[model samples]
Target: MPGRLQHKAALITGAGSGIGLESSLLFASEGANVLLIDVNVQAAEKVQKLIAERYPNVKSAAIKADVSKESDIKAAVDKAVELFGRLDVMFNNAGIMHPEDDNALNTEERIWDLTMNINLKGVWWGCKYAILAMRNNPTDASKGLHTGGSIINTASFVAIMGAATPQLAYTASKGAVLAMTRELAMVHAREGIRLNSICPGPLKTPLLMDFLNTTEKRERRMVHLPMGRFGEAIEIAQGALFLASDESSYITGTDFAVDGGLSSCYVTATGEPTLPPPSSLA
Candidate 1:
């Protein structure tokens, strides 16, 4: 049997590490020709090599492009089409969370701008180009590179909820991404291009763990996690795979929360006794 993303061409940003890296591998395994674009050329190349070795039939390429630059994004998207003859999925997963971004007051101008450039503006560019490429391509179910494909933006659960531990810049950028995804989905809904945002909860990625450098910092957020643990990058990648495949044909203009119930929890992580606690004992 053919894979879910068979014959599709996917262009993913930040494909060098973390969720982006995992998604690239998974997409290729599912029969998509993946274009792994990242600022780190060596890292991207390594992933491409690994994909080639593991899945010799899967076509993939490592493209060095900083999402913060619109020119680079355009070139990356174009290269995907050039390489695979069409574009089917666009995963705008590149983002940053600086240590300096404690809150709005503590967040420096430089940090805010940097985060928005990559996380917000970068997403915009990716969508713009991906839509343009997809709109023109005729959907061919037989070939598996369907017309007007899926665009998955990587937002965060922080976009939907306020956090006690604030990374104001990161939060703000993600919120913008969610809003953008909704509007873009609406604009292109009739045209057949589905736009969606994946709002991932705190995951065990280097980006989050490195920022939460201290055990105390990690524990502070852990109390809010209903799952009692962080999510894995592969988990988020699986969500991306669903959005990328034809399985989500009717899903668009919505945010898919791949969080560990952190966004829905009202109780504190303190494990304090509640009125319902007595029922649990019974």
Candidate 2:
């Protein structure tokens, strides 16, 4: 049998590492033609090569792009369309969280601006170009091309809940992403395009590990996880896979929380579920 995304085409930003790289591999494995966009050219190329070797039947490419630049994002999307004949999924996953991004009072102006630029503005650009491209896609099934596509933005658990360890700029940017995703999803709901955001909790990615280099720091962050551990990148990628495929056709304008139930926690880290003693039934 064919894969879930048998004939789809997807463009993934930040495709060089972590969640992005994992998703790129997963999407290709599921039979989607993928375009891997990243600032790290060599890293993207490496993954692209891996895809070529592992999934020779899958069409894929690695393109260098700094998501902070609108021109670069636009060009990358355009190139994907030119190469694949249509755009079926857009995964805007590039973002940053700096160790210096403390509370509002301590966060540097440069850091604040940089975080918003790449995280917030970058998502907007990706959505903008994707909407434009998908709107007039020559391959629309109605016009003999593919059906409407899915757009996934990488927000965070911080977007919905407050963090005492305040990476203020990161939180703010993600909050903005959630807001943008909702409005866009509603606006384009009737146009065959689906827009959604994935809010992830702390994950075992280099970005998070590097920020929490010390065991003390890592432990502090882990204490709040409902799963009692950091999530893996592939776990989050699997969520994206569902949204990108037709399985989630009716889902849009929503935030898919893939944080291992961390966002649902109230007081303590999650543990085994409690069950009533069986003697009462007798």
Backbone clashes for every candidate come to 1, 4
Worst lDDT window (10 residues) for model 1? 273-282
Candidate models: Cα lDDT each: 0.88, 0.88
**Model 2: which residue pairs collide?**
139-145, 139-146, 140-145, 141-145
Residue 32 lDDT (model 1): 94
Clashes of 2: 4
Cα RMSD of predicted structure 2: 6.3
After superposition, the stretches of candidate 1 with alpha carbons farther than 4 Å from their true spots are: 268-282
Instruction: Candidate 1: count the clashes.
Output: 1
- The CA-based lDDT of model 2 is what? 0.88
The sequence of per-residue lDDT tens digits that candidate 2 reaches over residues 208-280 is: 8888888888877777876566777887888899999989999999999987777777656446534321221
